[model samples]
Target: MAALFADPLHDQFGTWPVAYIPYGGADFGEIAAVAAEVGNGDDDAYHAAWIAAAERLEAEAETTLASGHESSARELYLRASVFYATSYHPLFGAPVDRRLLDAYRRQIAAFNRGLALGPHPVRPQRIPFESQAMPAYFMPAAGYETEVRPLIILNNGYDSTSIDMYFLSAVAASRRGYHSLLFEGPGQGEMLYEHGIPLRPDWEAVIGAVVDFALAHPLVDPSRIALSGTSLGGHLAPRAASVERRIAALIADPGTWSIADGFRHAFAAMFKLPPEAVADLGKLDESVMQRAEQAVRADRSMHWKVIQRGYWVHGVDNLRDYLASAELYALAGRAEQIRCPTLITQAENDPAAADAETFFAALRCPKTFMRFQANEGADGHCEMRNRSLFNRRAFDWLDEQFNVEMR
Candidate 1:
């Protein structure tokens, strides 16, 4: 499969918007135009190009709205929101770029405007957390708006926003007659960008609050609440489900057992040390740390991933500290605690899924492990390349698990 850009990082994140095409979050022509404007591996060029595209669509959306083309305006606004959300990935380091903040605000505004114009009643919510509130949106299944219905809580990973979940998961869930809740937790979206909250390992506390909100909602069926996490949420969701028994079913797209797995592998391969030697990244020797740091400095991708985004998300200033913080986010001793039926997915080429089998094997509850192959065109992380297929199979599994007949 040919990539959209010459730069690996650019191609990886740049094509993310295409995943939403089925639900009106983007168009291939619009995404191709932006890709044409960006230079290979050029972060600045990527940021500028996406921003320009988003602004253009936003203006068009406004014009369309003024002319009373509600559907056209709504689609334009939603697509603009996707572009705005796509614009800030390359600028993810701290002291946060003003451009990133501005883009995020624009994304949220456009998304809200688009949803506000849609036929469905989408409600924005603020789930109370410790001394703060987590921003959330509840989109009820059509025809079941006022009745009690099973709900799917969509949790995104390290780099995606709640708006992304709307296109990636919520829309699909809604179409299948399932109410969906899209939210941001600590170190995610609004919590990280606006509140300066770093990522935390104890997701049980974060999800507990979200479950509380779901239980209180008149339209939510408390007995069939499901939690599905994607990317890093793969790990975060499992961690939460381990303790939050209210989650009747759990799904981890390309299941992740530990955040430190990548770090461990990098250290092993970079330093020529045995895997066991780097098993605990938090306890690395100073000499090994110096060498690893220098190696990361020379690699642009690693520099951005480890030094920039990793440090910022973990609220750490150095690689060593980032590694240490990441160690806390593992489900090694907790998988057995999850009482609900779990579905763990693994895409053939998703590096983050290297530990999916191990994680799946550790679970004591009734579980299913799903694998996506390259031949299926669904092997990309979170199966973004073909999310509809993934969602169809996943929701079917959920329906069966909850004993609810498919609509």
Candidate 2:
């Protein structure tokens, strides 16, 4: 399986173009090597390789952007996005960079262009749900231009940038012929920084707006639209699908029953602070809290602060308030309201979802649960590091649900 999915680029674009020869294949080679080295206990080496590739891609992106070659820049950015995704999480238990602002800025710009050049004729504008406008990048299939093919809206999990949608998952859907839209809403990626729209408990409204937009578009198959969320999105997507009956399918990886718990863990990891301190700090004024989040994202030690602020954005005043949100439990209660087929993917050793089995048991729907071993190499939260494996499983299941015949 590892050999089959060895090259991330292969799974995505199916081989780099010869036009990339100028780079001496450094970027593509580094990516493949890093993927091979990641889980073999050579985490530090993997991290170094991943970072070097990202830096190279970034430089290439700068040149492309400066030349006013939007198309080229977009592709370069797409490659860079994959590199960043690999490096974003430092393995060997190292601290995250406190100041990734510059890298993130470049990433957002690159992804924006990528999305702009790649448009699904049916749904052209990929707008955000919040009042502040942010673009959602989506692609529509060739033949299903008239029918309402089930629209699958993809959301990233905690600490994920929407750019990953382009390099990580969007390509798979494009290949599989699914009308898919990928976006960062609220506490996610650019939406949190560019727009003041923080995370909300009722993600249904966010997805609801997306669904409405898809249905209004000339090409979307409204009735067959589905919601797919990764990482924390696992929680957010299900919450939204429970309320929005129009969504025909709900697919989540690493099921979540509490956003508060998610925040607690993230804050603790990012800031290297105790959960109590993080929770206490969250009670401060909204402006103060936002600054803390920015500070944390900039400073590795303060990373926990970023996680805490994320919780506060979702209406948690403190740890107690967070625990009380009952957002996940309530969403679970409403799962029966979902009128579509559902898919839940869980990691066997994921600490975040220690109670995943229990949570899965509570879900009431036409659902399929897949358990992946931690050693499987694609078992991380939302399987961010393993795009090929994630796509193989997700698209395969989606095809079965849609009754799509294999080509």
Candidate 3:
């Protein structure tokens, strides 16, 4: 877990793809090479380095596929997709940079091509939602491609695409004899980037559509369907599960109490504000908002997280509205409504897991809290450093809850 790049922001984002190594999403040497190429580089340099790696892997995938080595081609294409996905984080802001758009498109293409050649049965889907459709993929469990099998629907948080979800959860779930559905909801992937959709607090409506899709599928076992959300999805999935009773089991990776809660406490600690002053962040006065904006803009990490990525995802034009919009994502009264068997995970060093205990304590369902430690190499956000361990424990719990025989 040592720093991968001198730039803190780069170090954090750069290490994400490493977690995908177990599923052929990357090789540590390739990632290390890219990191060395981008040492102390600015946003553009970071973008250029990753883009170069992605293109190289993509061309290799094409040549390998042409020679009919599908398995090798699958690995190369999937690896390329992860690199392309990693390349655009620094470029995430309004007036979407042309480079970001192009990289994202290539990322999707590589991921889909890889999926077509994978061992499992995969289908690209367009799940019906309000007016626009959410892009999704239904991957039937490897050996149960023609049978009714329990389904694990994977949801990603803040910045990950549906492709990231596949390496993070879907592939693992399929190997365990569980069908998988991975989708991009509002404010994510193509939903936001291609269709102009922004984030929404009412995720129940969004997930309700996903459940409908699963129910309609001949291979998915509706009665045993499970939902797992990671990162910001930690909150979104629970919020939806609260109302979507069809979800028989739930997993929130590093459970979050709310979107604004973390920011509120961080602000209070940073500026020494009294509890009451930072209590209702949504209603902070204009001057206070200006001060917060100034504080965020002063740091490169905070600038991208709050001003650029935050504003764009929330469909807001100013810091105040973004904070106001975040207020809608709270799970205070909502967590108690989730009735399914639930599992919440906490990673030792993940700042987002600060509220995992609070979220776990509030849950009234049959719930379990799983904690990952730094010594286990699974302490980062979402246990990105050692997801093989995370996935094993998570699905084992699901299997127990659903009375599933071990595979």
Instruction: Residues 237-336, candidate 3: write the lDDT tens digits.
Output: 9999999999999999979888998789888887788989887887876677778889999989899998889999999988888998998999999999
Which residue segments of model 3 deviate by more than 4 Å?
Answer: 118-121
lDDT for residue 27 in candidate 2, whole number 0-100: 47
Q: TM-score for all predictions?
A: 0.97, 0.67, 0.98
For every candidate, C-alpha RMSD to the true structure in Å: 1.3, 8.8, 1.2
Candidate 1 scores a C-alpha RMSD against the true structure in Å of 1.3
The CA-based lDDT of model 3 is what? 0.90
Candidate with better lDDT, 2 vs 3: 3
Query: Pick by lDDT: which candidate is best?
Result: 3
Clashing pairs in 1: none
Model 1 lDDT per residue over 213-317, tens place: 999998898999999999999999999999998999999997999998888887898789987779888789899989989999899888888887899888999
* Cα error, candidate 2, residue 94 (Å): 21
Residue 29 Cα positional deviation in candidate 2, in Å, after optimal superposition: 4.6
